[model samples]
Target chain A: MSYHSVVMVKQVPDTANISGQVMKPDGTVNRSKLPTVFNPEDKVALELALQLRDRYGGTVRVVTMGPLKASDLLRDCLYMGADEAFLISDRRFAGADTLATSYVLAAALRKLQPFDIVFAGRQAIDGDTAQVGPQTAEKLGLPQITYAEGILDAAGPKIRIRRKIDQGFEVLEGTLPLLVTVVKDAAAPRPCRAKRVMAFKNARTLLELEKMAEANSLLYVDQLKEEYVSKGLFIETMTADDLDVDLARCGLAGSPTKVHKIDSVILGANEHETIPANKEGMYALIDKLMDDHIFG
Target chain B: MNEKKQQVWVFVEQRDGQPADVSLELLSKGRKLAENLRGELKAVLIGHDVGDLAKELFRYGASEVLLADHPSLRHYNTLPYSRIVSELVDQHQPRIVLFGASFVGRDLAPRVASHTQSGLTADCTDLQIADVTYLRKDYAELLLQIRPAFGGNIIATIICPDSPVQMATVREGVMEKIPLAEPVAGHIAPIPYTPEDCDELVRIIERHREENKVDLKAAPIIVSGGYGMGNFQNFQILYDLAHLIGGEVAGTRAAVDAGFIDHNRQVGQTGVTVRPKLYIACGISGAIQHRAGMQDANKIIAINSDPDAPIFGICHYRIVGDVMEVIPMLIDAYKHKLK
Candidate 1:
């Protein structure tokens, strides 16, 4: 039996490749200056989902909740073989923590119902919270397995996952319609297939179509959207209004957690020694440490 | 202060019938927090036949133990653990909840938070209770969940201003674990196992646990490498020096990510927090996140080719040169001295 998998992906600031201009004077990041990459772990999650889809003879639908710019991430997902993609973006959905995020995601997933599995990265590097996937599972009323390393077996409605733990691994069996949060080492994501890129390169969400229409006066938003839809170049777009969610729980209002304060930590310099890298300096340093009984 | 004492609970995490050190650490920190709020510190120990762990929790400042002992609850299955914790919080309406940021805790906590509709934060470096005003709202005894954000470029203080229960997960060794000189007078209140048929839907078939032999936290001397160590072959020099000096080899998050070192030996905010007696930095340009784990070392010696590396500022000795040159010389010097 084929399974229907919905993989959640995110576009995060490439924290690993920080440039001098990316850091502001206040020590907080100028996030706009930092280049964005498809979050590494999320891409791995997508890869695992794609692999499952390949083996089980099914479709992989990818979803993301971010700014309109996140359509680029969805395009990358399409290039990697996701059969469908959905972007849930709205001004009201800003400043959402994991709980609020899960609210919107679960609503969007409900809108596209009857999916058997929801796959997500173990944690996003931007937040490093790892809460969104499990929270989404809770809201969806599905069992979740986090830190999933690899799928050992999947037959009929049952799937067994080998998940990573503290310095170890465990094999767990869960039924279909469950959530699995994949870790980074789970799989190396396949490169974008050249044929898929040439085909889906023109994929545009409704928001993107509206932008294009605005840029070209000759083009109307409705006509452009219809043309893209007929060409199968449309990325399904859902806004806050489209979701059947309580407004209060959609954005910052629904979020229980708030940022109290931020501190640009500047560590006070302490007294230190300057030792050369030469033989004499190395010997002296090791001797001093030995004298202090720090090393044998 | 509210006349009714606040309820502060720590989820006492156990694996294979042994309590996790981070749980005890939270109990220690929870005691201080409960005191500040004029509250009670309770340890929610949920595992099969783990009633014996309650006394240990009491020793680490838990005044009450809510025991959920059952055969099914022995291993950390998400369904029942989240249900029991969520139901307990719902029944008592606790003010604060703490969990170790371990795999099991991270897996179970969000589900519990979503179920109870409580505010949750992960990997908090510091937790404090404070009275504050925010956005024209006055909050009393809010849990100031402090964590380094944006790749440790800034530290953000987070709070759940609206929710009654503020939950946070702290990585192990972030907080100090100080057990009381004398155990507190606490009693175990057994929480009965209420079955949900859905709980059996997810089953743990087997576990492969590697008894982690790399105790970086307990090591006296740590020869730590970073991404700047150049290559995987360069990382071998660190083990050479570590062996010569009776020390352990560790790596920064970057080195670990670059596949130069294993993650268990990683030292950083996301990795193990180590405060060894001596930490030798090898070609490491330390980020604030990396420093958070090793900055507390009694004495640090940074060896980097770039003189401007951030690690140089915190280290006791700054060796401005290649780690390749410095490490082998140190190893050779040690071998000669021994001879």
Candidate 2:
């Protein structure tokens, strides 16, 4: 039997390239000011899902919850060999923490049923909360394996996984219909193929098509969407209303955790004695460290 | 039931019938929070034959131990454990809950919090109870969950104002486990649980635990290399030094990402946070991310060519030189001194 794997991906602001304007006065990050990229660990999760689909004959579908602009990441997934992509975006889903985000993702997963496996990144760099994957699994009544390093076997109804624990690694045998949050070092994500990139470059979500139609007044949104759908280039779109999500449990209102304060912490050593790069300085430093029992 | 009177619960995680160190640490921290809020500190123990472990919690400052011993609870299966914990939280309506940010705790805490519709903050470095004014109203006792964010560049304080239970997972090694003072008089409350007849969703057919070569968290000394080590061959110097000093060799994420060291050896936010007695940074330009994991070490000695590398700023002693030259001098000096 072919295995169907759903990979949850997110378009996160590249926190590595944060600027002074990245943080607002209110303690929340100004995500709009930063350039967004596909979350790094999520790409690794997609790579694992693609490898699973390659070994077993099935399809790899990517699902993401973000704004309409997240369609860019969905297209990138297609270029990297995802068979199907779904963008779950809604205005009501804005300002969602892990809880609300997982609630929406779980509802979307229910809509995309009959999946044998689910993959998610260990954590998103922006939020740094690794709760969505396990929280989604809990909501869906499925078992979860977090910090998965590699998959050993997945041919049968069960999958053997090597997962990272506290200090070392543990090989766990988990059954099918499981959610596995992949670690960053699980596998190197394969580069997007040029041919696939060219083929799916025009893939557009329904919202994007409407925007395109609006930009070009002569073009009809319905005709453009129909053409894209017929060409298998339309990324499926789901909103809060489409998912029948509880309005109270969709966004900022649903999120219970609030950021009380954020401080820009610039770390520095106030009084460090700088030893010269000469042998005398090095010897003196060593003598001091040894005297202090730091070298013992 | 007065929700305010509910006790602060710490999920006592165990492995091989021994209580995890983080569990004891949380019990200590939970005791303080309970005292601040004028409530009792409770430990939730879930495992077969964990009755003895319940008493151990009392020694660490748990006033009440809620035991959910069952055959299915022998191993940490998410479904059964989370279901039981969620049920307990719903019934008891704990004001706050704490978990160790271990592998099992990280997986289980969020699941339990989600099931109970509670707010959870993961990998909190510090937890405190303080009063705050929000929207012109006073919150008398809010748990200030403090944690490093943005790759350790900033600290974010989070509060769960809406949820009945404020849950958080504290990182291991961040908190010190208090010594067993005079054992406080505590009671063990056993909760009866029966495994459901439903088929097991995920079954652990086999578990192969790797032989740990290095326990960085418990290491007394760590000689860690970074990208400045230049190449994979350079890491040998660190290993040699650590071997000489009865320490372990660790690396920064840059060194690990560059394939100079294994991911397990990575010492940073994504890897393991260590608080060794001594941490020697060789050729590492310490970023905040790297420092976040090791800054808690008692003493840090940094050797970097760049006089202005961030590592020097955090290290207790700074030697501005090529690590290649400095490490050799250290190894030679230490070897001769030992003789």
Model 1 earns a TM-score of 0.98
Show what share of the native A-B interface contacts model 1 retains.
Answer: 0.87
Number of clashes in model 1? Answer: 0
Q: After TM-score superposition, what is the CA distance of residue B10 in candidate 1 from its true location, in Å?
A: 0.5
Q: What is the TM-score of chain B alone in each candidate?
A: 0.97, 0.92
In model 1 chain A, where is the ten-residue run with the lowest total lDDT? A287-296
lDDT of 1: 0.90
Candidate 1 segments exceeding 4 Å error: none
Q: List, residue by residue over B1-339, the lDDT tens digit for candidate 2.
A: 455565899999877577887788888888889989989899999999989889878798788899999877887777888888989999999899999888889899999988988899988878999998766778878999988786555788899887889999986666778956688899999999887743266666655555557678889999999988999997798888888888999999789878899877888765678989889999888766677789888888889888877787788778877888888887776666665
Name the TM-score of candidate 2. 0.93
Query: What CAPRI class is candidate 2?
Result: medium
Candidate 2 chain B, run of 10 with poorest lDDT: B197-206
Q: For candidate 1 chain B, which ten residues in a row score worst on lDDT?
A: B330-339
Model 2: pairs clashing at backbone N, Cα or C within 3 Å: none
What range of 10 consecutive residues in model 2 chain A has the weakest lDDT sum? A264-273
Best by lDDT: 1
Candidate 2 lDDT by residue in tens digits, A188-212: 9999999999999999998889999
